[model samples]
Target: MQDSSRFDNVISRPPASGDIVPISAHPAEATSAVLHRQIRHDFPTIARGEGSYLVLDDGRRILDASGGAAVACIGHGDGRVADAAMEQMRSVAYCATIFYTNTACEELCRYLVDSTGGHMARAYIVCSGSEAMEAAMKLARQYYLEKAQPEPRRTRFIARNQSYHGITLGALAVGGHKTRRQLFEPLMPQNVTRVSPCFAYRGKTAHETDAAYVARLAAELDAEFQRVGPDTVCAFVAEPVVGAALGSVPSVPGYFKAVQAVCRKYGALLILDEVMCGMGRTGTVHAWQQEGVAPDIQTIGKCLGGGYQPIAGVLASHEIIDAFSKGTGAFIHGHTYQGHPVACAAALAVQRIVAEEDLLANVRTLAPILSGLLKQRLGDHPNVGDIRGRGFFWGIEFVQDKTTAQPFPAADHVAMEIAELGVAAADYAVAVYPGSGTVDGVSGDHVIISPPYNASRAEIHTIVDRVARLVEDYFAAKNAGGPVDAKL
Candidate 1:
């Protein structure tokens, strides 16, 4: 029988006809049966985490290149964050927000609102980005009802194509990811209309200038609003820097300004979904900052708590809060654990660490270096079509034909294959976040390499080197007609 321990139980070798092995003999099978993301695959058991590496049960340390969906802003095993959570637990770990509010929750909310320089007057803490998005959508609906004019017809939302908000039904309704929503389409709300995203790579024409492309996209959004009836729209939802949906794709200059203008012209709120790209991931505290416009209602997560605890939030502008105060005197939404004390404490510590340590400065200092390294190493590679991102959040879009920008078929599963190979390979020893359907919602492939904001120059170089080598070797092996190890 093949040694399951050797491969970290990532994959089991097929047995010979004459050989028989019990299912229980597999290392993963022997371990606790946690319902993992994939039921068929034997995933590696992560034993521990330190710095920016995840140590598996087999003692192999995989460098976390993507921060587990871009969450670990301060890296792993942060003592201060842990201590904060512990302290909060000792005081009052759980509190029903409706009955009473705790100090941790209040403080965290204040910190978040203050971080936005009062642009966001209130914060509604939630458990995950999906929940935050759901709250944002619901709040927008409520906001309209609270208005003096009370346009009850404003029940629709306008989002961009190929964009991701979150996974909840309301969020999924607003999101434009075709694959995620395909299975749950019937259950989703039919109140969203999508326009073309500001994806310059695939959406921009060869002869078009950046300004012209932005104008074109703006026009598309305007047309969609017209098609759906502009006054019927409550908010225009988008991610300032498109995250996993389009591989860290950022909009062109003046794109957000144009979109915001359209939203303002129609009296619709601009909702920025910054769950992945916000909280200093893009060198700014808010991803929308660089876009020259602020979101009327913004959802933030992932790096907000830096994965220390399950936490996310929606930030509302003063206008929205004033409307609620004057009309309803309260938001109608409530979650049992809306402001869980422990989660708030951990997030507070994480955000404090981000501010005190001046990690945003580090991100700004290292952004150009990381970008330069990626371009220097993989720019000329045939399969590497585009390298785009800001700050510590970078993505490399892979192409089947670089000249024509033709993507590999969806069946290829190129991004996931690269990610699996990267983690399993001994030499590369890195973990990257990969996603598909970059083109439209079913074709292109890309991998994100967003290391922690605290990663040093040496760590950044290591990440770049390993990622470059992994991509190069994987494609080289395929071109040579050798069997590619990764099946999925």
Candidate 2:
């Protein structure tokens, strides 16, 4: 049991106020008014970015390994997206969706729906994934009201345990992260319930077959629907691939199909939250493409605008839209920036770049190479418990005992330390996305590495090599009773 605190130096911190602070110090001195994500931790000031790397204010070049939470799909500093947004701004920056819809908005929506092969007939563009999810929930409720056999009691939603929907009140209510919800539990709505996620690594029995595992998970969903009263559930909400909360764990084959069946049996809509996994991050334009099941309502973000502008959207099936068209001709919810011309333009440009560059093909071709490299480097490491994901969206879960798959205590902050070391280590400068509560929403540790879609094969290899070295060095230092890294 090594002390986690001994690794604090892994992340460079800025000097205290009144002194000339280092560029990496917390950006909040008496002169600084910015409210940072963490008040106590030092934050590095980013100066600029290139293709797949970020330059710190002090000129430290770090590879954008996880794309800053997998949002920067086309890499940073794309002139095309910026130009598109500026072009839209010059034409029309803001238009109320209720009154006027801009061409960019309409075109972006058309592109999204068309990409779905007409399965998703409508699109509701918003500012964030949370907003998209919130919109989806509202639409589902409104859809039932428009139905001939309207079930007014269908206000509840059934989501999965260890799943992450979003940060807003409605979105958070459906999320199952125990830690994020602990303080806000009293404030969140009580209409949502949770069932087990298809986490085969820990949830499945050792001898269970894939089919049996899928069947068991489907049974759990079925039982949950019965317990909650099928007629009372508006929808069954889940991520096509569990993100953030459970590490990038994709469902087994036939899993989504089985869950969709359960939702159909219960007469509840199926809502797939692809905020983190959709929009070509998983090689396909839509992650559900590989699953062989279509969601009644789908939410997408992250890669949608490639971090050029804040944007997310909801895609609804023809049936959901028809209900509104026939009943009220309107959805009851609206956002001030629901269809901002600038956001839509940026997203359109990003999507166009993805298509023109044929990046999805690159993802499909390179995903196996990255996976193989990771396994070759760290598969036998004691802390490497599981390596799972599809396409370029991958997660590496850390554990205390590999044989038992026992996670390290949350207090150790294993994943966070690795991420910090990746950036702070003089030899290996790469950014990664780290998360906790991978086991039961309070105890597991994992880190995600989702490089930009345009990341070259050499860059992927470099990213994996750096990640492996960081892990090995961190533990080697711990065992030798030293700092977390050799050159931190």
Candidate 3:
């Protein structure tokens, strides 16, 4: 008999029930002592890695595809590589580059420079990919300064959309990934222009010829250069193969040649970021080799040390180094860990194994087999719209329909769902690098599967089989009206 209005005024009403509450102090989401060690992962805890399998702390042996984002080129826990690392660590963990030099660092530098086909005169080592990219940007900027272009010959950077350089300001400025830059837009550098990426699946018109597509893209670059004013442009930066931003998308033939010509015409340095696709992951020692052009500056990471140590580096052409030499006798961009001894040692061991074992041959041999298997199994998959990639690295782009080529809605989380199913039901611990906005900057989904270079035939087959099953099952569940796992 009480008034209905009074009863409806309850504090825990429906609308208020789900509202967020403000608390002055609270426990952190990441708890436990191990949380301090690494706050990123929840410890799916891999107990061990043998060959290409990761034995999780839960006793599941998951096939390690994508080699931890193409970092583990060689198989995990390789004793020979381990022994090399231990040897160097015991001999000398570090040496200050400013005052003295170490054998490990000097030898590694010489090896990389020599391996660079007489192009890279010098190599500088750093801790990770982001650091390498930062160094590349600073180096490129300093090169222009050293050349005495006092009026600031370069003010704009031309990079393609759906590209990822790194996380730091200078590198991030040229990076075109929307999701990653959304939060940091305020602090990013100005005058960096985003051009169209050489992505054919979404970008290529149905009736357009490959040659026409390349021309169109080249024209777009020219237009962007004009918009920014040719002399005002500093560098043309890109990943030889689009990595996290576009899921291993390679450019069409004549694409880079055209782009390179344009960059040269504009006096902009061409920076190729091979952080995820270089160092034999793409079956070639250098991804740019297939492109028929050489970059003025190149950045490499991840597989450089094969995850043996956190190491990355930049390779500079003699021209850029010469400019610096003639002017200041230095590049004027130096990092404390610019050439860490231990990192160089670890990368040397990894590189030696790749060369001695003839692993590039392995990469070439298995690439076709993996691609064939992916096509044979999931090529016709309803949910799998496109199967595209090269070398041992591949990506399965999911879509609503293959005929229409319409992507699954982003809210469906199709890529994430497929990733989870692949992990749980397939028992394959695949590294999932997903890309959104493939259609534009916001409307597509895909997953990358880059197996280690040393992965065996059986491991490769298992990866394909498991991932195929996962993709099939994901669609089955989604159509069945069951809740799809949203963790891709």
Tell me the TM-score of each prediction against the true structure. 0.94, 0.94, 0.90
Q: Model 3, range 320-348, lDDT digits (tens) per residue?
A: 88888888977656678767777787788
Overall lDDT per candidate, in order of appearance: 0.86, 0.86, 0.76
Clashing pairs in 1: none
Off by over 4 Å in 3: 1-30, 33-41, 148-151, 426-431, 484-488
List ranges where model 2 is wrong by over 4 Å.
Answer: 1-27, 486-488
Q: Candidate 2, 342: how far from true, in Å?
A: 0.4
Candidate 1, 292: how far from true, in Å?
0.9
Model 3, global lDDT: 0.76
In model 2, state the lDDT of residue 85.
95
TM-score order, best first, reads 2, 1, 3
lDDT tens per residue, model 2, 159-276? 9899889988999899998876887899999999998989999999999999999999899989988998898999999998887888789998999999999899889999999999
Write model 1 residue lDDT over 16-88, tens digit each, in one string: 3422121223545555486544333356668988989988888989899999889999999989989999999
Any idea what lDDT model 2 has?
Answer: 0.86
Q: How many backbone clashes does candidate 3 have?
A: 4
